[model samples]
Structures are given as C-alpha cells and as structure tokens.
Target: MPALGIDIGGSSIKLALIDHHAPITIAASDHYNQPSPDQLTAHLARAATRLPIPPDITAIGICLPGIMAPDGIRIERSVNLPALQGTNLPDLIAHVTTSPAPRRIFTDAHAAAFGYWSEHPLPDRLFALSLGTGVGACVLDNGQQLLVTARSSGHFGQIDVGPCDDPQPIGPDGGHNSLEAYIGLPALHARYGSALAGHLTTLTAADPPLRALVRALRIAHAIYRPQHIALLGGLGLQLAPHRDAIKAAVDEHLTCIADPAWSLHTAESSHHAAIGAARLASA
Candidate 1:
C-alpha cells in the first residue's frame, strides 16, 4: 500500500504518494503564492480527497511549520506565518482526510531531519539545520525518537546572535532579534538593500562575506557538538562556493575540543519533509 505525505509551508504545500520504499508518485502538486490558513486547509482537503490511490493507503502524514505539541492540540507561534498560531492541526487534517488509518503531524524541520536520517542512517547524535527563508534546527538523539519541546528544536533562527540590535521589520512587538536577522534571505536583502541580489550572484562567484557566513555556521555547529550536521533547504544547496571554507572552519573549531568527530553534509532534496513524512507514515 502507498502512503500519502503532505508538507505545508508558509509559501507552498507539496504532496506525494509513495508505494513501498520506491520513488514517490506525485498524485497532486500545487504551490500557493501566499496562502491563508483557511485557503491552505481547503487546498489540502481538496488534494487529499482526490488522491489517485487506494483509500486504504498505509498511512497519512502532514508536516507543518511552527511548534506542535505532542498531544497535537495546539500550534505555537509561527514566525513566518502568524495565522497558524493556536490551530488544532491534527484535528483539522483529520477532519479533512477522514481516513480510518493513523494520521501523523510533524514540524517541517523534524520531518526533514527524519527524512535525512532515513536516507543516511546516521549516528544517534545527529542534527539538521534547514536554511530557507528562515533557519530551523532538528535533532535525533537515539535514531528512533523525535525530541519534542515547548521551544521547537529547529527554530534556531530565533537564537540571539550578538550586539546588533536593529528594529525588527516584522513588528516591534513581535520577537525578532536572532541569527535569522543576519543570515535569512529576506533579512539579508533588507540589510544589503539593492545589493542583495547582486551579492547572491556574486556568492556564486565567491563573495567574501558569504564565505564568512559559512564559517560562522560551522562555528555554531562546533558549539553544538553533534556527531553530524546536515544542512538542508535551498540556501544550503547554494553553499558550494564556501564548502571548503566551511569545512576548514569546522575543523579548526573542532581541533580545540577533545575527541570531536562531527562532519557536515548538504541534503540532496528540497522535498525532504514530504519524503520523510511519507516514510514515517509507512513505518
């Protein structure tokens, strides 16, 4: 039997149907430019109703942004998407799908981490940082479990970086000052003004600040001390120019710490959350 996986983001939603452990058969794929909560829920329900597969599929999984409680009752605040706060996602999706089999919901970062581990089969102490519009972090401690916390693991973009206090663009009341303010794409654009696009183009040509950014990420990983750090999302894929600098920085930082044995890798797919959700649903 096949399993259905849905990954819901602030900007887009992706769905896939996977049979056994083979390639995913995309039943329906659509991208919403900027979806409202009701619109997103309706879109997912419409897609789920028209799935071109057996009704008795193995399982169904949905991955969402923001922090989800283990009991699945409440969704904590979402930085990118404010409308999702306090939503009962599990019940909402259940109402939408109405399928008899078990349903699962996971944070997008958690799903991506699980998907990466499912493919790589890494050590117990592995973490994944997804650098997209924002930054998220997910960690697997024993390879069989997903850590749940009031503070979502992969929301590392919220971590305070240093003494660079600028008024937050999102809002003054909204909590903002974090590493994301420095490295997230939108924030980078805001800071660099018109030079942002050119900077990315130049990054492809080896920009110095971009290289320094990679080194900073490596330094953060060294402090975390995970056995492996997997960088995911679109920005991570474009880090090839600074790959050597990143590795060197990681090595240099680790040299001071006794018995440090961590390594870094970039994830191969943007659909990792969907893939992982499908795999978890089947499992």
Candidate 2:
C-alpha cells in the first residue's frame, strides 16, 4: 500500500503519495507556500477529503524543521516557523484525517537522509546535509539512523566554522560563525539579493556557502567517515550541476579517516523529504 508523506518547511509545505514496494515510486504530489497555522490545519482537512485513497487505510509520515518531543508528538521548538512551536503536529494531522491510519514525525534532515539512502544503498555509511531555510544534518549507518531521538539528529548547522571575529550573518538559531549562518536562505539572500537562484551555479570553492560547505564536509568526513555525502533540500539541490567542483573542494586537505571512495551526491528531487517521511512511516 502507498503511504502519505508531508513535509512542512520554513517557506513551503509538500505532500506525496509514496509506493515504497520493490521499486519505489511517487504516485502523486502537491505543494503550497507556507501558510498560517489555522490555514494549514484547514488545508490538511481539505486534503484529507480529496485524497485518492482513504486516510484510514494509509500510513502518514510528516516531517518539519524543528525540535520534536521524544515521542514525536509535539514540537519543542521551531526556529523557522515560530507559529508551530509547541504544536502537536501528529495530533493536528490526525485531527484532519479523522482516521486510524498510523502517523509518524521526523526531523526534515533525517527524512531527507533516509530518502537519499533508500535510493543509494551501497554506501553503508551515508551522511546528508540539508540546506534550506535552515541547515540540518543526519547520518545513516547501514540504513539505521544514529543519534536520533526526539527527532534530533544533532544540529549540524550550529557548529562554528568561521572565525570568532568574522562579522558575517547568523541564522535564526543565532549560532555565531555557524554553518547555517553561512549558507542558510537568509544569509544567501543577504549575499545575493534577488538573483540567488541564478547565482548558485556560479559559486566556486572560494565563495561564501561553498567555502563553508567544504569546511563542514571536512568536519563530517573526520567524524563520520561516511562513504557518501548527500547535499539535499531547497538550496542543496541547486549545487547538483556543480557537484564535481564541490567534491573537489571537499577532497582538498582531506581528513585521514575519510573514506577514499567517499562521493558527493544530490537528491533526485526536492520532494525527497516528503517521500522519506512516507518511507519512515511504512518502516
């Protein structure tokens, strides 16, 4: 049976029907700009009514950019979407579905990592960085997520990568010299005004985000020694065309423990989190 996946981000919300059988496939999908909490609740209600399959029979997976309670029922904090803070996302989704369909929640980064890992299983150890409104990271070892509880996979965005005196921007988390401060949407917007999308392709190893990303990838390699490192999310996928350059930059000054065959990759689609959410629920 196909499961439903919902990914709520700082600027958008997406839904997908995922058939994760022998050959995974997305049967259907939808998206909308982020809206008020009440509007989102109404939208889910309408979506439930219009779904091609009954909610009662479908498993639902939801992911959000925030810190969740240990049981995965409530949001402890949401830096991007303050309106969702303290909200019981699972209950809200269930209220709209009004059915017995099992539901699960995940941190957006972890979901994206699992989604990417599902497609590329050869790499026993996979590390993924999600760059969007905020930055998130996750690691999958042999298809099992590590250090994940309460929807936490460790805050990769908060790691200080810049000099203390560097007067660059900071993300919502207010972690000075943090990775997110260097590459998050707000920082990129500050660096490249309205032409951000066009500018992603032109970024080089010496550029702001890429430079910071290389530093972060080096840190990831030293710690995790992942066989594959995936760049994912809204902004991450933009680096797809320049993968070779980014990989070369990371390969420079490489860590001794890093995998010799470690490779860089991008998610096949921006909807990976939503699809991953469904995959998580099914599991």
Candidate 3:
C-alpha cells in the first residue's frame, strides 16, 4: 500500500506518495507555495491529480505548522500560514483524496523528528529544532514525542535574547526582542529592507543570529542531552554551508558549560517530514 505524506511549510508545501513495500520510498511527489484557506482543497485536488500512480492512497499523513483544534482536524492558528487559521484539515484532505483513509496530523516539528526517526533509529533520544518562517521544536524520548498539542511545541522563537526595550516575537503572538527577532528571515529582511535571495551568504562570526543560534544550541544540549541534534527547516538547513563556523563559534562559547559531545546533522527537511507522515499513516 502507498500513502500520501504532506509537509505543510510556511513557504512551501511538499507532498509525496510513500510506498510501504520500500518504506520511505517516495512513489511520486510535488511542491507548491502555501495557498490561502479557500484555495487549499483545490490545491490538494490539483496536487493529487499529479500522483505518479492512481487512487490507492491508503492513508494521508499531514504535518501542520501551528495549533490544531481539540478535534484534531481543524487548524486553529498557523503563525506562518495564517491563511489556514480555521480550516478543517482532515475533511478537506478527505474530500479531495476521496478515500476513507485515516489521516494523521502532526506538528511540523514533531513530524521532522518522526521523519528523522524513521530514517535513523539508532539514536533513541533526539531533539529536532526547526527554524523556518516560524520557529519551534520537538523532542523524542525512547521514540515517544515530548510535545503533542494543538497550540505549539518547542517555541524556540519566543526565547528572549534581549537588549531591546521592546522585543519582537518570533512565535507569532507577542512582540518581544525574542530569539526569532534575531534569527528569523524576517529579521534579516528587516535589516536589509529587501527580498534578495542569498542575502545571508556573507554572515560574520560575530553576527547576532550566529550568536543566538549558538546560545540556543548550548541550552538545548544542556537540557536534553540527546545523542544527536538535527537541524531542520529552511533557515536551519541553510546553515549547513556554515557548519564549521557555527561549530567553532559554539565551541568558543561553551568554555564554561560541559561539552555534551552530540553530533549535529542536517535533517532532510522535505523527505523526513513526508516519510514520517507516511509511517504514521500506516500506524
């Protein structure tokens, strides 16, 4: 059986057909921009039309960016995808896929962790931090997720790294001189005042985001003490090119704190999210 795994990102929507015979095998996949609420069902309909194979989609697994209703179907509020504020996810997906297939909705962060777990099971303890249009995280302990709710998890963006009298919020609600204000793309955009691609290519060692990320990493390491910490999401993956610099900076900053000695790996943002969803679809 094959399942449809969808990863709903603030900037992009990634979906794939997961082949059970091959486990994480993606039979077919598609990518698109995050659409508005009214356009979602149609977007799903169109994306569904392009599947490599036809309608035997056993179950649909979706990873959402924000809170879900208590019913677990309606998305209450998405910081990045505010358009999905009150959409009924399961019904919308069911209407388009036209199968009584069970749907599983997970926080994008949890999905990332689950997706990583699906691929790499050797490490039972994992902490996945996702930095994208919004910021949050998820943790796995002995294969069980630490945070599962409609609200939000690992609100890393809200962590206050202050100097400003009024900090802007990274989590979506309040505005504070929070970590998101320093590390988020919107913050970079604000600094440059343009929508240029690769504007962050020339980051410096003393850059605020670099400092903030190192600080966050140290705190997460001390708290979770996971065997591995994988970085996910658009900005997080973008840091791959600068791994050496980031690591060096982290080492320099951790003189007082004991080294946790965990390895850092980049999460296959789209692949892991989809694969994890597919695995959960079968569960």
lDDT digits (tens) for residues 213-281 of candidate 3: 777777776666667677777677677777777767666646444445667777555567767776777
Quality of model 2 by C-alpha lDDT: 0.77
lDDT of 2 by residue, 143-186 (tens): 78888545456789888888522576666787778998888887
| Model 2 TM-score, 2 decimals | 0.87
Off by over 4 Å in 2: 20-35, 42-51, 69-72, 94-96, 148-151, 164-166
Report every candidate's CA lDDT: 0.65, 0.77, 0.67
Ranking of candidates on lDDT, top first: 2, 3, 1
User: What's the C-alpha lDDT at position 6 in model 3?
Assistant: 78
Number of clashes recorded per candidate? 2, 0, 7
Q: For candidate 2, list the clashing residue pairs, or say none.
A: none
Top candidate, metric lDDT: 2
**Candidate 3 — which pairs collide?**
67-150, 167-176, 167-177, 168-176, 168-177, 169-175, 169-176
Off by over 4 Å in 1: 27-34, 42-53, 68-76, 86-96, 145-155, 163-177, 189-198, 204-223, 253-255, 258-261
Q: What digit string (tens of lDDT, one per residue) describes model 1 on residues 84-184?
A: 77788765666346567777776677777787788799865777877666667787775554455553453465665433433433421244546566566
Worst 10 residues of 1 by lDDT: 164-173
